[model samples]
Target: MNRRDFLKLSGLTAASLALTTLRPRALQSPTRKLNFVILLADTMTAANLSLYGYPRRTTPHLERLAGRAIVYHSHYSGGNYTTPGTASLLTGSLPWTHRAINLGGLVRRQLADRNIFHLLGSNYHRVGFAQNLWADLFLRQFRADLDTHIPSPTFIHGQEKPLVSQFFKNDELGAYYALDDFLLSTHHVVNPTAGSASMGYLGLFYGLSNRDIGTADAEHPYGLPSNGYYFFKNSVLYDGICDTILDLHRRENPFFAYFHLMAPHSTYRPTRQFVDTLVEMEFPTKQFHPLGGRTNRRTLLEQRKVYDEYVANVDAEMGRLFDSLDAAGVLEDTYFIITSDHGEFFERGEYGHDTPLLYNPVIHIPLLVFAPGQSQRVDVHTPTSSADVLPTLLSLAGKDVPNGEGRPLPGLGGSEDGARPIFSVEAKQVSSFIPLSRTSISMVKGTKKLIHYRGYEKYPDAFELYDLQTDDEEKRDLYAEDTVTAERMKEELFDHLADAEKTLKK
Candidate 1:
């Protein structure tokens, strides 16, 4: 069946079914409040942005918007990985409580039935648009709370060529034809995994990397080629998502649109135009860290340049999205939030996320909230996790913030003095014998932070403490030296964990 036919067969066409199954009954209420637009960048580091004083012109649009929004300098994600961080953002609960640590996990089953989407659905229209495979995973969970969920186009038409065609030059076209036949007939293909099983399938076309059907060429297919930099300049994910936001702005109703951008992540490709701009800027290359080693200062500097350029590209696209919102006259009524699931580490031995080291580079993300009629900039020094996002957004919409582990943020007029202990958990995976096993749990109260390793056999685990008043980067380890401070922090952390367990049991 074609895409439309498949959607029809899936019972997605019935408005009543979609509304009843996808949304909460509270959304049917007559109150119309603030609309929400959450723009999430995958694997983005706040330190890379010019607005955050990265020494590069990375986020011109964001810098401009920061003047009119509240920029939280110390905002951290609840977890170090995508699924857990995103789960925390959506449910306002730590990963340990939400239990959505991996790719296939579902948030709806584990957490309380109260989500920002579910709470706002009672009064506003909820929609989502995601570009990355991980974002798609969250979208699947979000579908349970949204009034309308729009699946992003897997591939862009003019921007990206078929992956199969790019890899296999001579017979690439023919190969795609053969792969298409296999996909249509068998509904299952081994070479290039079909549907959403593989990352390649999540692109614009399903047959982008089918080797059996396409012709082989000199270029590498499985890995990114050296000349792969060209594709970043010409890629379509940014513009395509911008167009979606524009269309949603024109529709009637207070809407919640969650847009996820895949750029500035990995396979780090900044458009040639952006790269050229960086070159002209004459950024210091002495600090580039291509290999991600501690001593590769030159490589680190160069990688930062590349990361900044990619962020600039995203910023330009965001300018277009913001302009569209302003033109649609929804800018004032919208509660806009821009953040990331996690940050990337340039090869520093940390190529991607989920590192053993919980460094600030991986967890410290940019968080900016622009609520209607709120103009003053408020710096929230208190430690805030991604888990607080949902509750804060719900409260801003004049809805009762759901009862969850996350408390409403103080600066948004929802709560005051965010003094409660905040915790973050990371679960690498689960074993068959133990159902809900996790990797590590990190808790922060006041200035102290503790990380407990549960999945590993290591006893006493590990812990790190940072007095935010003095050390923000968390460079010095005070665990061993400051016994009294460490013990007090550990007690606070355990108390919060025990309380959460009791709440779950009840």
Candidate 2:
């Protein structure tokens, strides 16, 4: 039977057991396996964290936890954007192998026929709670096996809330209400009537009314109430995820919880308290990116201030989560992982992820793995990719991924010894206007790094080599300067690519 079918049957059997009386045998404890919690942040970069030596103390909790965890300092993402990065993480395979680089792309069923979630669901209860829409899309693919999928309700307005159209006297103006108009016009598949989707519609209506649908203020009610404006950085999402996790932890059944947070991503508004902290610290204001054809410097600065405040706010919430888990005495028993899907560029000529640049600021992410009773702080210098996370997690869970592109992380108990060269790929563009014909691939082995560009006529077959030991910032392109080193790195990268291609064919 497929993984989903097996899970359904097992869940039924598990429901009949007396959970309170059940306890995992000593043989099946940490030595054999343990529960897992992967906290994924959206559009987060390690460069901005205090753990990575950033000037700002953006991640005090992560830094404190790093002492007890194995931190992979040189970890990278498999893809430039969220969809591809997350898919690679879940499947433990490259984008080419997974084939889920774009929005509607499906993962290769042959190589990773069953994802980590599916595999866990077969043996354990799997639940996913995501705060972002993109993560919801990813979780939707495993709806049958997923025990629960809770989207962030921070910005949502219940249908019980009055509609904006009710305030308008003119019928035409009332019809102009974006939320009411869209809901009234669109065909509802599950519930044909308007009330069924009222909560969703009201959220959109209020969001549009305040002109803060996609901004930090979306978390606030009516975009008013100074205290409410800081809701984005509040512990709402963290609390929701923690409650779900605690619930699963209390259950006798083993469970896998994927908590994806939307904090420190955008709409950088932090709580008033956090804002006051930033003001006291007098954080430096850096115009990382220019306002492209815009004349809103004052507004933009205010937005950035909010963003900094939110980061600090999230850090505080993270502290709370750690404390709660420790108080529950399950902190060490849980296999905790913390990482981000992708990093935000803050307009440095790039406002978000999916940028053409292959800089560390965009792809380099913070990866921390904490196993139960494991105190060794091993820093893995060998380049690692997000694609390796799934297989690593599976290996920890006493499972196997036969054709996974990623290897189990080293230093972890029961981890294998084979470490392969890591590579990352980004499709140049998705739209015809931006020329979707090119591909950028980055390969790293030891201190040598190479970036290869294919299909761009001007830079076609161009390669850039860098000795990360000397130039970590990647400010200088050594491709033209060091021909011999570039050629060697290029050949090695090509060989790795060829092997990946062969594996895909098989």
Candidate 3:
């Protein structure tokens, strides 16, 4: 660990002991009006952050903030990308249960109402905003629960509505996703989706205006390289989040606010000051596997350099946000949660999170919970999932957690439920509902992880096993070497899938 992180963790460890010794009610009152906020930073990978033992200082702000929060070192997302990952966080169910396994898909209609926003009930005012168009689909799916529903691209790029309206007018239409399938797939339309046409226009606009996806200038501002429907810069998005927090603070009752910010995701546009500083750092070269991945070594290293710069920029912005929350006195009375929808990959012949491969970098995300009156930091090293976030928050809010695959998070009054098995499934290439076809599934129990690939034309069902404790990089595969262990895990994984199918049959 870096000196700064070492000092912070030491201080937190001392504080945690004191807080735990005191009376439980002394921390915060359950009867008092409490607030909840999920600051979802898109694709902020745990593997890259210094807090998780990376040599580079990618998350100094979060590292300091960890002194007063609950940090989960082994947190995994439900899927490799925005759609299923964010859906799992929202609905407290895995991709298989939620059936939002495809890119830019919505939660299954049957499970839509059970979303956290709706389950929190009518007691607190609920608000939602997502800069990523794909994540906004799930929020739109649960629109009935939100008391204040802001436009997905509002307050971004300055004149967000007017600029985006050139392609994304009528915000309430959800960018006409149903119609999008028609236009993007077959150019036929009965009731044409307005947003589909806008997509082409917006793409052209971004192409013309955003010639440099990796440029940040004073004139352009906000590092906004593109004005497309799906992306935003952290510089701009963080400002809007602070403004929204200020607005929500004045409401009569407590509120449950969800802000899923898209930054540190792609294009990797950090400011001029951040670029080229960490360009020479050496990282481990990943060993190739048979599952299939292709990217040049130079390109992967370059992407990692830019991605680290972007993460630094986001860290600075988050520091400003923490100051604002502290000044506004929200820190002492809010259940503030910080996490990511998914993580990015810069190794094993992959740069971004387009996953046919379920490597650690693409699935492991950072999860920090800062409960009100939490004076000392407590770290939870147990493997956890994005799906558990909903149930955990519900338990804190004094609400009955609905019937879902995830239970209450550990280290927060939740005990082990028999032999807990954490699962993450990726099936963007195939049907959302039937994920086993053309898919990759990750099953984690203790330190051992099993990656299963199924229903591929070239590569049929196969498996790769890694003991994370010994092989964090996942360079060595032990599937053939350890038959007994591999077979046991495979049987357990199949049993879990069978249960998910049974639920679908219902």
Candidate 4:
């Protein structure tokens, strides 16, 4: 068969497989076990949401849902990007412990079994899915513990090329590293490819085919939303999620489902209805960092507008999904949690989360928990980390909370600690196996935040301190003025770093 014929046949085969695999089994009476659903939105920062006091009304749906849910106001992610941020959430440990610090990296083999899936155990039906390839690696790592591992492209539309990860299910990680990352690498800007000449020719054809299939329809005016790997529609994804939840509701056992959706991350393409609908607003101008991307303020504001619109679009679909599930009585026995892996940045001359700066916009994420039969909203202003999620979930499941850096989240079987230290690490440039020789660590203790930069040529051993209570914008740097607070925080930060590095030796 010709190349065109081969591609077409592959597409048809994939569709057939999806239809057969996704069809629900014979329905059974629901059990008494509690259900848990974690809905993660990639690169969604609380700073951009009206739910978190942003001037723009970007999340009306989430705001309405918060009426009966528990909202966390001061939540931070473990790292600036997907690998480490997601690893922390899954393992209930910081990036320093899990060592998933690099792009497309996996958790340390020794700590492999210490994830949420294993903690939930066989009593509950564990399910995992992620649209972001980087976040999907964690699911691939713990596939053995999962009762249902959904394919990344199961809900994606207009897929022409066969995915290496889907075909080689048993060895998805290795296959992805070899074929998708090296030989048939189409995503080059974020991930490096081996640059095979023959594969490049084939990739060109694939791109053309994909473009033809992924043309903007009437529903999506700007374009179909993508995760840099494939194109998908927000409505289709949400509908699939609702269907999955309904299927779970009919099952005999309780379930722990993690759906990591790729929206409002990048390539912000909202629907026609959401585009240009947000009020134009100005953000506070901050000094550019030496390590920043140096993007102009006007461009940053413009990108923020588009990002806000995309967030609104995602929120609308989420509202639909929740309403459908509630109508189906799925919410009666489920604990629904909504959060993000990491957050986006649009200030200090940086347009995305790729920069080394560990500012609030790039690390502060939203956390909302909806308990069964919840009626009144509960707000927790105590600072929390993504690492806290795993332990909290276990506690809610009536399981023993494991020993880790994270304690159960406040208002959920854990007490609030106002002075608790929350740390976020950024070390994409450093090797995951080695001790972190060069990195940026931000320590948030109560309302004060101290950012320490180590082993960089431009700003070696630098420090920036901000009292978030007073300067939430982080306009004023209090490193020099607040000598007592600065020295105390600096010492605490370094001492913690020293302790984390010591684990590498053993």
For all candidates in order, the CA lDDT equals: 0.60, 0.62, 0.77, 0.86
The reply for model 1, stretches above 4 Å from the true place, is: 1-33, 108-112, 158-239, 276-302, 374-376, 416-418, 431-438, 454-460, 502-506
lDDT of 3 by residue, 1-506 (tens): 76655654564565456445422542356667778899998999999998898888888899998887888888999999999999999999998888898767888889888899999988889999977767877776787888877777576543222223225544543444544433332222422343456664564555556445424576333356333443355667787888888778777788899988777778667776666666378888886556556787888888888888888888888888987898888877788899999999888777788868888899999998887776677776668899998998788777888777888876554643325778998988877655356788999887789999998766789899998877888988999998988999999999988898778777
Judge candidate 1 against the unseen true structure and give its global Cα lDDT, from 0 to 1.
Answer: 0.60
User: Count of backbone clashes for each model?
Assistant: 26, 3, 0, 0
Error of 4 at 357 (Å): 0.7
> Which has the better TM-score: candidate 3, or candidate 4?
4
Flag regions of model 2 displaced more than 4 Å.
Answer: 1-33, 109-112, 151-233, 276-308, 346-348, 413-419, 428-437, 457-459, 502-506
| Best-matching candidate per lDDT | 4
| Model 3: residue 159 alpha-carbon error in angstroms | 7.1
Q: What does the lDDT come to for candidate 3?
A: 0.77
Best by TM-score: 4
Candidate 2 lDDT at 432 equals: 15
Better of 2 and 4 by lDDT: 4
Ranking by lDDT: 4, 3, 2, 1
**On residues 1-506, what C-alpha lDDT tens digit does candidate 2 reach at each position?**
76644653453343223111122321255544368889887767776677776666677877777666677777888876777778788778777667666643445556444677887655677887655545555665555567665543443322222334333333422332343334442224422455437566655465456544323343442232221112333465567667777888887777788877776676554555565455423323333322122324455445545555666677778778876876786665688888988765543334456455566766788898766654445555557789878877776677765566787665542232213557777773443123225777887766667887777655676677787767676656788888887887787777766776666557
lDDT-better candidate, 1 vs 3: 3
TM-score of each: 0.73, 0.74, 0.88, 0.92
Q: How many pairs of residues in model 4 come into backbone collision?
A: 0
The collision pairs in model 3 are none
